[model samples]
Target chain A: MTEGVALLTVFVLAVFVGFEVVSKVSSTLHTPLMSGANAIHGVILVGAVIVAGTADEAGVLVVALIAVVLATLNLVGGFVVTDRMLEMFGARRPEAAAKDGAE
Target chain B: MIAVWAQVCYVVAAVCFILALKGLSSPKTARRGNLVGAFGALLAVVVTFIAYDIDNLGWILLAVAFGAVGGAMGARRVAMTAMPQLVALFNGVGGGAAALVALLELSEPARAGITRPAGFGDDGWFAYSPLAESGGHTESEILRMVDLLSTGTLTATAFTVLIGAVSFSGSTVTFLKLQELMTGRPITFPGGPIVFGAVLVAAVGLGLWAVATGSVTLAIILALVGLLAGVLLVLPVGGADVPIVISLLNAFTGLAVAAGGYVLENALLLVAGTLVGASGTILTRAMAHAMGRSVSSILFGAFKGGSTAGGGEASDRPVRSAGPDDVAIMLAYARKVIVVPGYGLAVAQAQHTIRELVDLLEKRGVEVGYAIHPVAGRMPGHMNVLLAEANIPYEQLLEMDTANGQLRTADVALVVGANDVVNPAARTSPGSPIYGMPILDADHAGAIVFLKRSMRPGFAGIENELLFDPKTTLLFGDAKASLTALVSALKSL
Candidate 1:
């Protein structure tokens, strides 16, 4: 009936829907799924920044500031690391030259 | 007016998230998906700031600057091999942040008197929400009562933080092992089971105590217990099972994040966390089935005894040895060839070389395809990702079920750095650990060429019975070097 109750109900349903999507996907896609989801940490960054800016209380403000920093690090750092790892698989080897001549 | 714009931006961000997820489902579009997700995140952050009602500009700027510098440094420095470890570390941070947020909300002085809705009324629904408002109860009194009840939000947060921290550390260890920075052997104790049982009991007991007393201190102790439990849980698992363990730990991290999300009442956190948790669980289950092991058996380290070296008596029988010249000549003239990859290919970082070798074979009018075992490397689908990176065609990368039937019809089965996946032990010995686990029948082919570093046992810690078969010929060397030599010899022919 109330706004709070409505927010809570929607939140609960969104989580359930998210779980359903995860269950239906194949296991072979796990790594890529994670790489995609890790980017979503940026949402946490947004939340942290908002909380930091708006909270009047000193304690809340301090915590929000810390959260913002951590969340940003996670978002950017995770992508960089994942990209570098993917590069290892994509790089062409020097020995490939020998195979080229042979073919 | 700002709220309206912010809502619009949120909608846009949600769309981007959906599209990013769809793109990431296939390797060809994964990079684009990553970029789209990043843009969505950037949009969400900028929009949130625009709508935020903040009076203190100084603190906000400092936080942003610090976040930017730290993030840039981490991104620039971390290696690709350590990406999974970094993921674990970030998962820990997310869970920890959620736990901290929940605690701060509960301890807020302004919201001190708000009581738990009477409608909830001991229904045990709030059992997971430790900080649920309880009417007519002082903070200290409620804390004491919650300590006694232990099943509330505090317990959930504590458990999440504890598990997340352990996953972070354990994943780092696994990354090092995979990269050859650490030994791939299983670290086990003489009485590992008893110690594991004790830790589990302590963790549960302390968790209950923290809930009953609503004591944050006790919750912290419970967290430590969980942290130790995670380390103990993973240490005894051998190299062969690392992929499954990594998948399982990924699941644990996901569940922890979801718990934290529930505590913080954040919709995005819940959505992302639940998605990761459920997927990780399914992957762990699939990997376990592929290995012919139960989840419980993996957790308790009961499968170690079956992984004996030299268990295959047939390995003593003499087998043929093939030089690169002979093998290349045969392959160059062959109509069709199927390449079976194993951990050895991964160890030598030879996927690119293999890809080149395949190209050479194709130029000779040979139909070449790859046979992928479900549990080939340290992780599920490890070979697929590696091969895909070399720009291998999806049509050529065949699953075991599809590829197995074709192996017998092929002119040659050129197994590169693979072992147990092609071993005949799975079929011949019902008593073996990998007995029922499906394998590629490389022996059934007209000719078999095994490329291996040595005669060492594979992940199961047992000698491959296929290695000694009369039909199989051993071509020993580093996979990259061996494949290169084969290419040269083929060109000479």
Candidate 2:
């Protein structure tokens, strides 16, 4: 198969997989789910790295490095914040609850 | 060529992302799902470094380090109430990164063997005689040109640059609106739609022209115009609908990334980006449904002079104002009380205080439940997050439908810094901006007591008729202070 058609095949199937995975998510998880999806797109860091690493000029290198920084922020901040939010749901012991309320 | 092992690993990481989204469907496994996704990201990055001969290794590592520290710090320090804005900021930066990467691709095709297209000016903005620069080519050389400048790749590049720019700027506007750095109300000028339309058409023209001729200047111009279009697309949306816009922009970024993946011809980027694009679209639609709004209405409703902004002027109509002791007595005597929390409660950081009040009420033999509107707080289910942080048990929080059912027999509906969600107009007045939004049914309770800071309208900017109802009493103060006062007053009783 040609390269373009192969990529298109992956794209089409991924769209279906995406829809099926989150289709039944309850409204309560919408916020975290959106946040998680936000982090997933940070995979663009791979493209940024490729561009930066292959850059033949100083200016291009600088711009690509900036992209790297921004992608890192998106990927790292997104997952940490989501984990913190979800942590609230998981740790509901008596001691944890008292500590949270005391603050 | 990248090794076969790397391609297989990319497939594995893609599955991890799919499982991540799947696990988020239920609260029971959400955190683990996020961790799993993080692991996938780490694996993908490691594989890329190992498989490719990347240059500027030291600089890239330093940049990654700086970004990691900044991201973790921001995530750690932000209060739970401010999470929507933080998410907007993170989404914005991701989009900005994608746009930058696409712009770089115009001058520097990243793959080892691919050559940069000819006729790039020194400043990287202009191109002169792109076709003439490649003259005197052999048959195989011409064929190589055809492969490098394929219509599909150029179209993907155009899509990436435009949509990525739009997502970046749009998310920034949402962040500003949510952070109250800009006006929460829709800001519109006369002939706003015409101006927006003109820019949008120009952007599309530039995109097509760039795709056909592979002009670097035209591509840069498209990016600039896309930024303006993004700002215009979001400036007219009111505060309550901003979260939905953020979701849509998140989806926009996802599609942009997917196109970026196509441009780069990397399977990993393609799969992950499309997954996010599809899921973010579905989530945005679901949120709009929860608010009883259509996606188009939420976006362009302001352009048609629809109900976008409400009059912010406080009404002079008399409300039966009461003191803390009176509210305490009302709560003390009630058999069952329902608490309707809103954004104001979060602004005052009153979740813990309200939790204390609920605990005291329960101790006094009053059954309590929190009525959570689907669109309450800043985003969908944001109130639940704030209350969960305050250690409120999951069972005490009731969704809109269930809470509405129980409000019928509840003795009192104590609305703490909440207005529009309990307003009677959503059910009664067709002209109201929030008319069709399903509310908490606070009007169905036996007695209604509101703890408000002022007589001003709610976030959507419409005054609530329930505040003036004969059966309603208002205790005016900050949510935290009022709840604390009520706690002391109930103790004295």
TM-score of the first chain in candidate 2 relative to the native first chain: 0.90
Scoring each candidate complex against the real one, what DockQ results?
0.33, 0.84
Question: For residues B38-157, what per-residue lDDT tens digits would candidate 2 score against the true structure?
Answer: 989888988888887799988988988898899989999999989999999999999989889888776542222233344322233223314344444544434434444556777888
Q: Which candidate is the best by DockQ?
A: 2
Give lDDT tens digits, candidate 1, residues B183-219. Answer: 6667777898789889988877776565444455665
Candidate 1 fraction of reference contacts recovered = 0.38
lDDT of 1 by residue, A15-66 (tens): 5544444444443555556655654544556545654665667877887777
- Assess the local accuracy of residue B285 in candidate 2 as a C-alpha lDDT between 0 and 100: 97
Query: What is the Cα-based lDDT of residue B308 in candidate 1?
Result: 64
Interface root-mean-square deviation, candidate 2? 0.9
| Regions of candidate 1 where Cα sits further than 4 Å from its true position | A1-16, A23-28, A38-73, A80-103, B1-23, B26-36, B47-152, B290-292, B309-319
Show where candidate 2 strays beyond 4 Å: A93-100, B109-148, B302-310
